[model samples]
Target: PQQPFASSTPQSSNPFGTSSQSTTFSNNSTLNSSNFSNTINCNPTNTMNYNPTNMNPSSNFTTNTFNTFTVNYEDPFLLKDITFEKVEKKTAPFSRIVPKPIFSEATMKPLLNLTYRPPRVTQKKKIYTEPSIEEARHLKEIENLVIGFEGKGRIQYIDKISGTELTTSNIEDKITFLKNEVVVSDPPGIGLNKRARVYVEGIFAFSKSQGDFIVGKAEKYPLKAIQERFVYSLKEDPYKKFVDYNYETGLYVYEVNHF
Candidate 1:
């Protein structure tokens, strides 16, 4: 009768059962002599199945009646009884190898076709600097004039009509002669004149070939026709041998002739 071991345990304020209440026992709670003797007899009867090493000090399954212990329990990690063994290394050595290159069926046909002709390579003809329009026109004119000379000898003219007759050697002299010889409302105005002196070796030059022949650059002509007769003169005579004719001294001296 020690209050029957206070059948209900103490309670706490914890709602989730994380903490427990303190335990209390009466100082005079002692077992009776008869009950103690009976407990000793019962303990010996269960000694065959009892294990002292495996005894749990505070387990819920204990041989007692007064101490009504409740299991304050929880399952932490839900563990399994798993067993592990040691791992061993491989017995033999391992290696890796790389294979050589091989031509596939799809690429072979196209490659063979590419090599059949041995690859003919031709370079396009190129002119680095193109000629200007003006230069090209002048070149065409020269070509046409040269073509005109293919058949017959070019008609010729000269400034000197025979050794007995002598006319002006320059454009000014030619203009004065034309004014006195031919009558007109007005004389033909001098279009342009340029002084170009070329020495003669064989024939003389023509009056028109002097400076008055303005259309083209200077060239010599000799013995040109005047309608019916061949006026044996030297005007634009290309073959004429030019000489410096001193007008003041009235003397003619030979000089080197060039184109």
Candidate 2:
């Protein structure tokens, strides 16, 4: 060869030679094409290492850093799905109650006076005679009335015209006679802006033993005062009963309804 290539074989006692072993030793540490490209891409400082002979010498050789940041061959186990359960609510017994209808200005119209009256002869002779009898019977009736309402209380007397209290001495005789007279009413008035004319004939306590209440301490024989817890009962009409006189208004009020 023209100027034979350098070899490791001795050359006329010259020290330098280019044998295969010597040639390979210098190239072994040099990067292949693929290694040079990867180095250049990953580090700008190593760009000088990207020589033409260094890029992918064989297709089978792949760098470890090649797919680390990409999804091209990522592990399938990293993908996951989460699930959760839904709960239903339970209701309590008697949770719903029907409300009763409320009667008020907003819900219903105001009610008018509801009175019951029987036909009457405005000018009957008996009416005139009865008033006279009533006046004649006053003193006697007063006594009976006192006896009838005995121990009722002070307020019970306020409703009457005479305003006499039987407890006093002056009205003693009048009070006694009233108790004996009967109670009767010819014309009944049961409504607003009206009046009831009552004629009480006899006094009767529903339970006679009930009278024992007024006789309290009578056994003591102290000749002392006694108080009777009296419960007066009377029917105002065929339909309803009025138990007693209103201690306040003195107006006849309905009794406790049995129904």
Candidate 3:
């Protein structure tokens, strides 16, 4: 029987799963048919090649890329609010004041009843009044003192010192003071008539909600130093509080509305 001719290359897997071992005996080695097989004819050029990466594209070499990154920032509230110099004006002056708007009684107390001090009357009397003032002016200014009206909470349209309200015939029942005093109920604002140099003798205290206050001496500010300190504190205080910087008027601005 005539044997088929084959090439001298080593055997390897075909791209297809099955292999043809029927040929390619290197060095002219011949194979005898086993059992009842006949000699076969083979072509040398009919061989196949094997590639492991070809089985799965994932096994091939690859490269990965990414995008460049960037970042940005913005101004903060503290920077926009608290600062070394003046802070940005985000709201109107005294805009933070939320009017108490609490209603006053409608009965309308009597206006400045000096008769209330009957037998107890004294030629020498010590008194403390709101929108605080000195003794001589305090007594004389009682009549002109501002009063709270309807819708206004700071002062009653009556003298707080003497417990008085607008008489039925005051004509519009408005306190005659400051900016269209016809019918407005806002209490009169206060500033000193002259320069005041107070000397605080005891503990000093103040607050925005309560206004300028002193305990030991000048009920509002006992010490001239304390007054200076109070004025400077306005710049530092978070509530935006401040005393009158006007040296001529010597005013202390309380947070109260109408004042």
Candidate 4:
């Protein structure tokens, strides 16, 4: 065996040819080991690691560090510099309010009344009639008009005030009414939909001039002036309810509005 270099220092018994077990072996003999010790001893007690080049192929040497790898790498992101700005504090002035009391109907003079006339209103009351037996049979022939059906239709609709029926050719010109009954809109008492009634430039709105004329007036007339008295029961009609019929006189006394 050759001598080790001057700088080489052995850390333990030579790993090349040494045994950690208590069993002793002849210096010149090879170990026939099925169960061997931890290390081997070469010639010197103080030498560097055993050189792989110096190891004998037939000696069957090994090391635990043969498959290990060591690397040194630096991260680019960790080395970058980051800067941030500082924010300033702000304060706002305080505000306070005292609420007003709620409204009272009694204290407040009515929004509108007899003296205070409301804005003018224009309304169109639509009237629709059901098909009579004779007309219903010719629905397909004369004109097919079903009440309460959506969309305009081609037919005759009555103007309630004039008692005149308008004949319309186009579908859009007809009116849609739910039933034969006319819709008498309740007078709007300034509660809602307070828009003025619009009329054409030349058309006259008779509503503005509505008033009662004093037909006749007498002071304290005697009951003896009427010798005969009569009472009659009139037909109870839902539409003509305000009118009373006199069987003796064959006359109808109606409860009419002056307007």
Off by over 4 Å in 3: 1-145, 148-227, 233-243, 257-259
lDDT (Cα, 0-100) at 55 in candidate 3? 69
Better of 3 and 4 by lDDT: 3
Give the per-residue lDDT digits (tens) of candidate 3, residues 110-223.
888876565755342122234344333325334334322322222222222332322333313333322112223433532211111111112234545547554433334335
Q: Quantify all predictions' global Cα lDDT against the true fold.
A: 0.29, 0.31, 0.38, 0.31
Lowest lDDT 10-residue stretch of candidate 3: 192-201
Q: After aligning candidate 1 to the native by TM-score, how far in Å is the CA of 170 from where it should be?
A: 39
lDDT of residue 14 for candidate 3:
46
Model 4, residue 215: distance off in Å is 33
State every prediction's TM-score relative to the real structure: 0.12, 0.14, 0.15, 0.14
Task: Please provide, for model 1 over 1-259, each residue's C-alpha lDDT reduced to its tens digit, 9 standing for 90 to 100.
Answer: 4553322345554354334454443333453322322211212223345456567666566467887856534534434445578899756534324454476544544534544565579642221111323343434222111101111111112211122111112222332112112111222221211111222112222344344312222233332232112112232335444444322222223211211
Best model number under lDDT: 3
Which lDDT tens digits does candidate 2 get at residues 188-258?
A: 22111012223232233222444422222233322222211232234425433454443223333332111
Sort by TM-score, top down from the best: 3, 2, 4, 1
lDDT for 256 in candidate 3 is: 24
How many pairs of residues in model 4 come into backbone collision? Answer: 10
lDDT of 4 by residue, 1-259 (tens): 4322112333444354653323232332233332343333344423566465565677656678978966435644544346667988755434324444477445667665668667789553433334543444434322323232222111222211211221222112433322222222323222111121111111111122234221222123232112112111223433323333322333333221210
